[model samples]
Target: MADLVTPAERRRLYTLLSPAYLWLMVAVFLPLSAMLFFSFLTDMPQDAPDWGVTLGNYAEFLSNPTYGTLMAKSLKLAVTVTLFCILIGYPCALVLAKSIKGRAREALFLMVILPFWSNSLVRIFSWAIVLRGNGVLERAINWVLPFDVRLNLMFTTDAVVIGLVHSYLPYVILTSYLALQAVDDDLIDAARSMGASKLTILRRILLPLSLPGLLAGAVLVFVPVVGSFMEPRILGGRMGTYYGTVIEDQFVAVYNWPLGAALSFILLAVVIVILAAASPVLKRAQT
Candidate 1:
């Protein structure tokens, strides 16, 4: 790879990559290092005159079960959303990749991925409008049914789940579609020639081959969803409190920067562990 590039080409590559690396070092790494340092302190140095390093924040988390429960709730939410995304998105991907063709397939695929082009905050809020009491969803239901029915989904766990699923569904679909699309139609036809049913082909061929991409998409959705705060707050309302919201409050509402930093660092560590666990499968997919 190195031998293929001229000195000028190498210089151009270095020039393009250097700024990104430098930006990561300054913007992300430096702040993260500072946050980690702050997490061990008794108080933020800016506010407290006699600040000192301490393990009190971590100790607080252990001593109080509330934080642990909230973290558990967050993990549960992540798992639920990931499962739903896989169930719903994978089939959509299969249809787009295998069932559809030409311009229509392209159009549908574009529609599937179009959500990513818009702001996520806007999307979540739109769900809130649709799900709230007597909102668009209820009205639509009422219009069709003989009796008036109220589907007050806002400020509920279900709403949170819906919002999250809608937001991250594209991730699973995009990855799964790419993986399934790579599968040759000839292989599937050959399976049919052997008198294999559709379900059998999907189970034996499509699934095994696409498992890595599915797992990759799950990881993509789960990690960020675990750390999500805004969607829960907007869609779940009073019932929206989760680990992410707690970390957010520690910084913004409570102004306990140390505790916030500690929580944030722990979340980052958990995310790293998750990615590390999934790395082997992702590498296998590439091969």
Candidate 2:
């Protein structure tokens, strides 16, 4: 197909991109380009009509401890949530893959995914209700227990982590389950016949064999977890001073377009760096 396109066809294709491409460039890429341009501007307030070109935004971000701390916290939260998702999701996927089959498996998968079918806002609100001091789930737990106690599960870093893990767990399970399903049962049978214990088979065979799915799931979980705002806003309370909130405030409330753009681009840089660092590990796992 690439070889078949003549000069005229190429010109026609470029001509066809005139309408939709213009909109895309205007609505999406142009703003992004402007953001990148303004990120280097200086000698002007964020809303100034004529902003001069400089690297002040980049320097300020680098020199300011507050932004630095926020970046670190966001990264740490993302890592922790990703790890939790992997730990919980791996076992769940393994069980589903090994035992369930046909409609039962499909049903179980649906159950895992059902939470995601509704609006994410609803999910966050549902968690808020459950995690509140006297929420239904807490009340139910109290009823089961012999003593009365208030569980502080809401408005903390932990709650945000839980929400993120819950939100992305399905992706991990689906990816890992697919990988587990593709594993050869004969390999396990052979290992067993050769006097390998169940634990050894799992640690040595299963984990290694399931690496690709695990990597895929990890990427799916981490990328979005780092950028999540609603989960933190509803669940994080005072401690939820996440960078996403900062970005939101800058763009929406303060209307500091240049600074917000700078912050957003900085975030993109951070994500790119992390992905680049992890890419080798992911690729090796696939191999």
Candidate 3:
């Protein structure tokens, strides 16, 4: 094969790409590099004159079971939120893409994304109001049902899950909607003409084609949820302590920047490993 670009074109390409590469270095890589350096230190250089480089922070992770337990809890929460998002978001996306059209589709999509317009704290607080004992949810249930009941869900794992799902559900819906919309309607029509069942078409055709987008949404949801502390703190109360909360405490309350950096890097490494393991499956879906 002939070379796709001459030297001049190659130079122009690099020239155009240089600004983005530079920005990525400054914005992302530079901070990460600094953190990696910090993670190996005994203490912040400014905090202590006796500070020295050591592997104790990383070693602590291996020696203590608490960190592992919290990490496992975070991963479990991430998985639960991702599954709920897929279950709820995909069907909404499908309906928006295939069932509705024009103004109605626009209105529904606007609703789906409305949460993004509001501050996340506001959203969490709103859920808090509804979930607290004798709150709106409890009142509504009591009003409709014949019996009195306490529906306080505040400060629970379930509340944290609900808040997270509400916050991240749109990622799945938007990605899946785009993927579903790209499918040729003619193919579905042809399947219908051939008397293929809707289940068969969905299972063998639509789902397979949309797997890449679904997985993308799942990844978007999973990565952040694993490190989430705010939603859990507000919603889970004392129950909301996860790996992320500990990391937050280390940085903010404890002022243990070195240990916090180590924990954050450990999280980043685990996330990378998970994505790497899933890459083959994502590639297969694309094919």
CA lDDT scores, all candidates in order: 0.91, 0.87, 0.94
Give the alpha carbon lDDT tens digit for every residue of 1-287 in model 1: 55846888888888989999999999999998999998999998889899999999888888989988998899999999999999999999999999988999989978888889889898988998899999999999999999979788999999999999988999999989988988999999999999999999999999988887888798899999998999999998999999999999998999999999888878888789878887886788665
- Give a tens-digit lDDT track for model 2, residues 40-94: 7763354576768776777778888999899889989999999999999999999
Off by over 4 Å in 1: 1-17, 274-287
Clashes per candidate, residues 3 or more apart or on different chains: 1, 1, 0
TM-score, candidate 3, is 0.97
- Candidate 3's C-alpha runs over 4 A off are 1-4
Cα miss at 262, model 3 (Å)?
0.4
Tell me each candidate's TM-score.
0.90, 0.87, 0.97
How far residue 87's Cα lies from its native spot in candidate 1, in Å, is: 0.6
Compared with the true structure, what per-residue lDDT tens digits does model 3 show for residues 1-287? 14646888878888999999999999999999999999999989998999999999999999999999999999999999999999999999889988898999989989999999999999999999999999889999999999889867999999999999999999999999999999888888988999989898888778888888889999999999999999999999989999999999999999999999999999999999999998999999998
By lDDT, who's the top model here? 3
Error at 275, model 3, angstroms: 1.2
- Show the colliding residue pairs in model 3: none
